[model samples]
Target: MLSIVSIGLVGLPVNAQPLYPTPDPDVFYTPPAELAALKPGDVVRARKIDTGMYVGTEGWQVAFRSTNSMSKPVMGVTTVLLPIGVKNPPLVSYQALINSLGTQCNPSRSLFNGELQDAAGAMLPIGRGWAVSLPDYLGPTSAYGAARLSGMMTLDSVRAVQKVAELGLANSPVALAGYSGGGMATSWAAALQPTYAPDLKLTAAVAGGIPADLEEMALSLGFAPHPGFGLAFAAAMGLEREYPEKLPISDQLNENGLWFREFTHDACRRFLLFHGAFRNAEQMAASKSLMDSPVAREVLRQNSLRHFDGIPSVPVFMWQGRFDELTFFPPVAEVADRYCRAGARLEFRPYEIAEHMTTAVAGFADAWNYVEARFRGEPAPTTC
Candidate 1:
């Protein structure tokens, strides 16, 4: 069990933001005691939701059976949006960069919050008369940085959609796309698809601002509290949910770390950025460089796209900034090259003039074109 402690203001800012209902107590999001009986992608339950905020779109929140990082049976929730007039549309699983530790920040909840960027981003695909699925791929606990769990949730989300007859997406051609945290999920789904869910008709994947090495991103932080530390520490806290024994995050925290963990459990992306702006991982950890320890190395390796053995069976289009301050460019480039050499059909683009956030705008058009072509059954381009 993870322990909770108190931290005074000197440790970290105590922004006690109100928490929305977490998964366990929330009736709609809760899973049954044992999921072992169900197969991955099995629709556990589903309920229609209002998409009135987005004109001419119908939506539903689906809870589907999936596997956790440990390959244990688990349930995941995804929000599916259908264009009001489209028939037999192709499916696009858009993994939102849900870089938060709170269940309230999951796409299922955020998709309705027009204020959030990803909710608006989902609109582009829906406007194209495509079925869009925004999965809370982080699992029931909002396991933020657990990529394998996210990947399985992503692929299984596609399956859940196909099984829902009312959605009319039976066996529809599928394409996946995401940026940053979502990119990690998209890449992991690509790498794990062949063996994990090869039955689906996966066409292509678009991964931008990819963080290929989980450990690199986690350990690259300095001792000082900075703007980017929130994302990193959130990831560390997120991973703790998946591997509590191996990663004693709650147990290892000093006063500030304890405060961070508590505040983040109920916080969202915006709060994380503002609160962690002046803090770093060293402040939370008892052993300053604990992320470099052997246990952390092994756990991070298992979740990282760079260390994965297999590549996606479908074509891939990857884009990144030349100098990304957050998810660095070199690691992403290396993953692209490794995939190319492994006989994977890939197209890699680097926005030479862009930075982390700038790459999103600079690379959007090309990524859109790639997804469009794949949906049209056009041949995939290659830079390998």
Candidate 2:
């Protein structure tokens, strides 16, 4: 039911269809051969970021085709930054703590033009002579809590960015790093890489404040004192977008819940805090509780990191703040232990920080050392 218009711009085969809605889903479906034949790291498009005071750093907004959680073809965008003088440098796929439903907040947009608060901070890697790939990861739809999809996008972004000749990263070593929501993507990507994108050479990964188990996260944070209630809600809302058939969320949500859903469409972290007051899924769902819903239970189980098989083939550095207000330490620790048992070369670091916000900064130096060593071909220490 899409209307066609005559706007001639070149590269047209007389009968070719042009996307009118800017991300008309039809565009993603087209040229199946191109998407299917996409090598793990094929570069689709790259455009330099022209704004902000980015000294000695050249940034690009890249878009590439990657598989979604369901293994369906999807288009993903990332922000790629390179140091002016560095050539063929090591790459770090830094997943930002983007726990927002708004599409504008994704790194491809917000961080691309250096408009968000995290923009300057993300540039730190470029300063280290490491080319950085900051993927929107969540896809064009902004599937905020679709962990596996985000992970796939992360790995694929690394692949696509490496192929960019201008970046000179054709054979560059790769590392993955993120905290909190970003950690969810990092951990999932690491665990999935062995089977999902085994062709890529991943040197190391660092995940801090990881929400390893979503079910536990819901139970522990969907109440008072824990501010993660909003995050949990956002996750559910996001998952619904990705797995609409499996989740069928609208049928389960009450009037108030539906209102919340509409309100969250363009909401970001700052707005989430106030909405977090609901504290419980029962307050949102018509079923009275997420535990009482079979669909919710199944979705939570499937998305958890522990449900997966082999861990990363490369070294992994995981850290958690013992008193993290958002991601409780115990579940994160337990999952790390599970990764260790699965024979992953894991170094689990626990800090005594009182909360989640400062934990990211506290663990920064250690993460840097770990990844830098991996880039230098140094062996990773293991607690296994």
Best by TM-score: 1
Per-prediction count of colliding residue pairs?
2, 1
Looking at model 2, report the run of 10 residues with the lowest lDDT sum: 1-10
Score candidate 2 by lDDT. Answer: 0.72
C-alpha lDDT of all candidate models, in order: 0.78, 0.72
Candidate 1: tens digits of C-alpha lDDT, residues 1-384: 011111121233233332222554568887877667999999888889998788888998888999988778988899999998889988899999788887778888876654256677667888788889999988887887788888999999989988988888987888999988898899899889999998877988998888777777655555666676776777766777787656655655767777767777866788888877867655676655453456667778888788888888899999998878777888888888899898998999988855676787777678878999988889998998
lDDT of 2 at 273: 63
> Which residue pairs come into collision in candidate 1?
225-278, 225-279
Give Cα distance to truth, residue 380, candidate 2, Å. 1.4
Question: By lDDT, who's the top model here?
Answer: 1
lDDT score, residue 166, model 2?
72
